[model samples]
Target: MKLSHLLPALIWLMAGSLCAAPPHSDVRIASPWPAQNTILAMLGYGENIVGTSMVAKKIPLFRQSLPRIDSVPVVSVNSGHELNPEQIISLGTQILFVPSSMTVPQQDLLRQAGVRVLAFDANSLQALTSRVQKTADALGPDAQDKAQRYQHYFDRNVALVKERLKGLPQDQRITLYHSMGNPLTTTGRPSLNQDWMDLAGAKNVAENWFAGKQNRRGEVALEQVVAANPAVIVAMNKRDADAIQTTSQWAQVDAVVHHRVYVNPKGMFWWCRETSEEALQFLWLAKTLYPDRFADVDMRQETRRFYQDFFAITLSDAQISDVLNPPQ
Candidate 1:
């Protein structure tokens, strides 16, 4: 589907007079991360955002105000055909910011087309720091302060999660089933989602069976999932929960019987957007699954604060509840 035509504020952003020393005037950034977009926009580089691949654009700030570009320069399945080199050169993009797993051939193509591509991933504590530094260097000395601030806040979030997870008893820890998509797939042992689950003090049920660096997710038979009987089944969509709830086959699962299913909040961009908001999502999910262990944390207030501080947007209590309480 073409998202470019649905965008409402592209003209307004482009029409605004350019700044004399716009830090990103000469640069064009394409990121799938929501947090990256928030940071770039906050620093007055929103106008410089020529394109976006952010999956969180459905959320309030992005849906209402962000520009949508004609095409994304990357493909998930094949890196070679991710972007057309001729088209990229025509766009006049000086640089492309991508995730670490972006293929070497894609990198070479960008270079050959006179475009610089930098890959980064902030899935772990250490990687987050490196990503900040690299982003700072790319943006020049002017972005140093912002980069440091990003580092400081992200560090605190990670530290807080680590501190909380440290004291949980292994046996008492919740068993999680992270529903990935249409087929109801889940994160396997080696995926980033498993890392987040571990960080949240939960044991991933699919870890032992599937093993791969990329998320080992695929269709999970309903009967099999029920047989495993996880303590918490985190379905990304409320609709999925309803579908499972209605299925006669799921009656055997402990999670279904005990009503222990939860859906992650929308607009928080935990799934697709890579903003610092993600750190907040990790915090929120951990607190949600183990409320007693994290009773002091207020995920709703925290999420609202993140939106206000980073995206310059505010969310209402009702909206927050909608994301937290999803139909079931």
Candidate 2:
């Protein structure tokens, strides 16, 4: 038979098996958030994933681990913000994981379709931890063990970094300018990126200027960055870091002059955001801000171990380098 003709039969068989299993045994999960997918994969629930948002397909680590990911249908509209309820229903998604940014009406639409909606706040470390635990609990009792193990690993790594940097005085911390894809765009106190900087013991220059602003992300003129003259500039990606370094207007900035600009790492997910790899992000940021203090830290080893422990995959040397120094 032609492969096209067999596809419908295959889908029917899979859907039948999914529906035939006990109510909680064959749960089909869909999430618009790549971080939540990463958490599910870490909890050994990758087989339960039936659908995901369009953005999840672009994550290199996710693609590397989940070979069948492309077979899963996307449940969001092209706009990236709106959910496609019809497509979601077609995919037979039982549970939908969404970020807190999702509006009430969107959740209502999914719930009305018999899809249970689980919303998580990924803005802070505590919130991210809670989300992970809650997601594991929803999966089942067996998943709780994996969640606790991950939590233990997270707590231990964070405490280690905290202890190492505890003695440093507040005045001695380095000042950082975090470039959110553009040199002119930066994150302030309201953003989770700011939380990463705080954990790394680096001060965010944008927070001082945008303290009372309602928006977490704000744009400042090139001249403002030159005026702030932060000690270091960290870009979300290599392209952004290169742009900051080459811009003529940034020539006089302290970070540009001193060549203190660096790109944050991109793994299964962007290290700048809340993800299962957050503990590694903290370590990487801390090391970037204070080399001498974290000189003994082996980034390659840490990255390798994180993938092995969390995703149950071992990365090659080239993969490790790619995650740390992604292409521009």
Candidate 3:
């Protein structure tokens, strides 16, 4: 069977603007967004990616499912912080996907060379929906339908989590801390970090600092974190979560004492970020924050379902563990 047959989200995201496309074999692309690469693969355009980014090239799950991922040249470094516009043009990349905040020094150069650079803001849930569409649009009609289906699945799961939490007391929202990249670095402003935390019915402590004036991924002092006294804490890496759990300074923190510090699940990319996996992130976070409220939600089963449904990949129990725990 064709790899396309194995990936059905393609049909779901490819439904709009059937203004047609080149032969499926001809749609070459490059992008600094790691999540965008995973989504393109889901739409059955994996082979067309000739230029990729450093982070996308390193995702373990992405490599396992799409071995060809290893063959794509890394044309952009960290969302174009260091991009090779000449290399992208040389690779014949038709579309380049990036965040609106892109800072590459040669963006004008890419346009001059006839590369269509598409930028979108994916800082919030509302914007994420549009981002997926914008990405799919470049892939042409087939990806548009897949984006719609993914959106429906995402929204439905959000509603399910919301409905399930309705029985909990209004005052039960957990006071939480979410660490990004490192143990103390966390969400600031204009990030989906707040969106999922809010969806999971938790109060993110960082949102209150500097009146929400921090960068999307900013650092907070250990003293500041202690003062927040969050009931739960989540870190982007297992080592950080372990630090919160075992370090002396963090020992007095409520989450550490209560054993609530957790390693965020990461698949194609950290689920806590803009990846399609945020659908599962909200469910997992809600369950972690209030196990009683989500007693019936089996995260293992949910993880298996998400990978199978959206990415068309079947995972072993060990693979599921890797996604949830992620290696240090």
Highest lDDT, which number? 2
lDDT of each: 0.61, 0.80, 0.78
Q: Give the TM-score of candidate 3.
A: 0.87
Q: Candidate 1, overall lDDT? A: 0.61
Give the per-residue lDDT of model 2 (tens digit) for 1-328.
Answer: 5544544454455456555454554788988777788888888888789987566778877888998887887766444466665556566677788887764344554554456788887677888889989998888876788889889988887887898898999999999998876768887886678877888899888886677776577788878878888999988878889988897988888888999898888887787777878878888888888888888899999999989988889999999998898875
Better of 1 and 2 by lDDT: 2
Model 3 steric clash total: 14
Q: Residues 149-247, candidate 3: write the lDDT tens digits.
A: 888888888998899788667577889999877887888555788989888988888885645464556777999999989999888898888778878
Clashes of each: 5, 0, 14
Give the runs in model 1 whose Cα sits over 4 Å from its true position: 1-26, 31-44, 54-60, 65-81, 103-114, 121-129, 212-215, 271-275, 322-328
> Could you tell me the lDDT of residue 178 within candidate 1?
79
On TM-score, who's better, 1 or 2? 2
Please report the candidate that would top TM-score against the real structure: 2
